[model samples]
Target: MARSTILIADNSCMIRKGLRSILQNLENSEVIQLIDNKEDVCGIVHKRKPDILIINPDMLPGDCLDVKRELFNENKLSLILLSNRKNLKNDLKADGYINYMDGQNTILDMMQEILNKNNKSSFPNKNSETISSREKNILKHIALGLTNKEIADQLFISIHTVVTHRKNITQKLGIKSVSGLTVYAILHNLISMDEVK
Candidate 1:
């Protein structure tokens, strides 16, 4: 069982302390950092590369999309929106959300789900054989969110060859989704998160 590293970013001291206290009780979870301002969130996140980041959407700097893109490009982590409203903003791309009014059980359950998903995506198939270097190039492109045609053109290979390599990569890793492959690539150091689009 892998431990999940968590970072809480909120302007409110009480909110940060409360979340940290509640999160500490979760099994195999650690509250690694408590951030009080938005400015430090991205910098710390890039440095620590926590497994989960629970933050208020308002804490994000300037344009949310740009900040999110930069943060995710550097670190593979789950983002959880922390808000007081029951109806969360639909625009934010987050794994989960925790309301200020939510009970301890609700928070625990949400965090657990994020942790489970992270663990599943982050770990690779142990019994699988080694991937060929050519297949690895394709996997890196796939993890970087490149289309088959793009990968084929970039590698000077046919689209059919790219597809075949993708199939082989999936078979070897037992990971079907692009997101899963991205996580695997990051974990294996096949591609850095900074390279992800």
Candidate 2:
């Protein structure tokens, strides 16, 4: 079985080394590298393409936000932010974030969580955002396995309108895949499985 790789990025080599040691000890995880140069992050990621990158948000060089985008957008790397502060009351949209604490935030827990996530993808939807009437209609139509064109015709709209509605629905619901949307639609009684099939 292939082991999962974690790439660590921080300004301090000491911090990186410590994290590297902990992560390498975690079951089913291998440390790809523990490096400090922020400039190296994007290049290394493009080359090695580790499954996840553990990066210190404060120690970033240049535009870390852009780096996050480039890594995720261009290189397709998942990011896990390492923060030293507690009580992150505000919403920050990273794949995950960890404060450098001792207790059950152990390397073992991190590894298990990541691997579990790999096998069974989970989306944390705490908000349960209310869908607009139009998005809900689009989802219902999709659940019925109607083509966008069919939905447009049924709803007396253009195919582009149906497509636009779908985009809005997924965004509002934070659902990225068809199966996720379908399951949600069924759970909400928007449509039946038989209808989709």
Candidate 3:
């Protein structure tokens, strides 16, 4: 198993230290960087290219959409949002979110889940095929509990096209049930847990 590298970015020293402590228990994982300022995040992420990034969007300037695009587009890494806000903005694309008040066990479990998913994706099945970006979009919508018609309407595509994409997704992933596909979407970071219905 490859070593999983994680970067923590938060303005709070206590939160950073606490998250570091909790992450220390993860097997074959390393906390590569602890960033306290938004100014240095992009540069560090570009250089280090950690496998996972645990960051607070508030630490970044503006809406952080530019940072998200730069980091995510450049690297295939998991982005976990660290926030205590009751209502998180939907614009921030994150693989997961950890509340400040969450217990250590819950945090650990979330990390472990991300690690497990990372591992699985790192080495996929030999016969397993990849899905296209369009299919992924449809799969994400499906996982979000959208009906076929809803997905078609949202994507501005015909219902027949949506159905075809869903069929292709099912065949490629070998997952027929919606629940199974939802799990796949969540694990693959296509959609966060909060987004799933």
Local distance difference test scores for all models: 0.85, 0.73, 0.88
- Superposed model 1: Cα runs more than 4 Å off: 65-67, 124-197
State every prediction's TM-score relative to the real structure: 0.59, 0.52, 0.59
Mind giving the per-residue lDDT tens digits that candidate 3 earns over 1-197? 47999999999999999899898888989998899988998889889999999999887656755456665686988888899985664666678889898899999998999998888887665235799999999999999999999999999999999999998799889999999999999999999999876
The residue ranges of model 3 lying beyond 4 angstroms of the native Cα positions read: 64-67, 89-91, 124-197
Backbone clashes (count) for model 2: 0
Question: Candidate 2, residue 119: CA error in Å?
Answer: 3.6
Q: Residue 94 deviation, candidate 2, in Å?
A: 1.2
Looking at candidate 1, what is the lDDT of residue 45? 87
All candidates in order of lDDT, best leading: 3, 1, 2
By how many angstroms RMSD does model 1 differ from the true structure? 14.6
Worst lDDT run of 10 residues, candidate 1, spans: 62-71
Which structure among the candidates has the greatest lDDT?
Answer: 3
Tell me the deviation in Å of residue 24 in model 1.
Answer: 1.6
Enumerate residue pairs that collide in model 2. Answer: none
lDDT of 2 at 119: 40
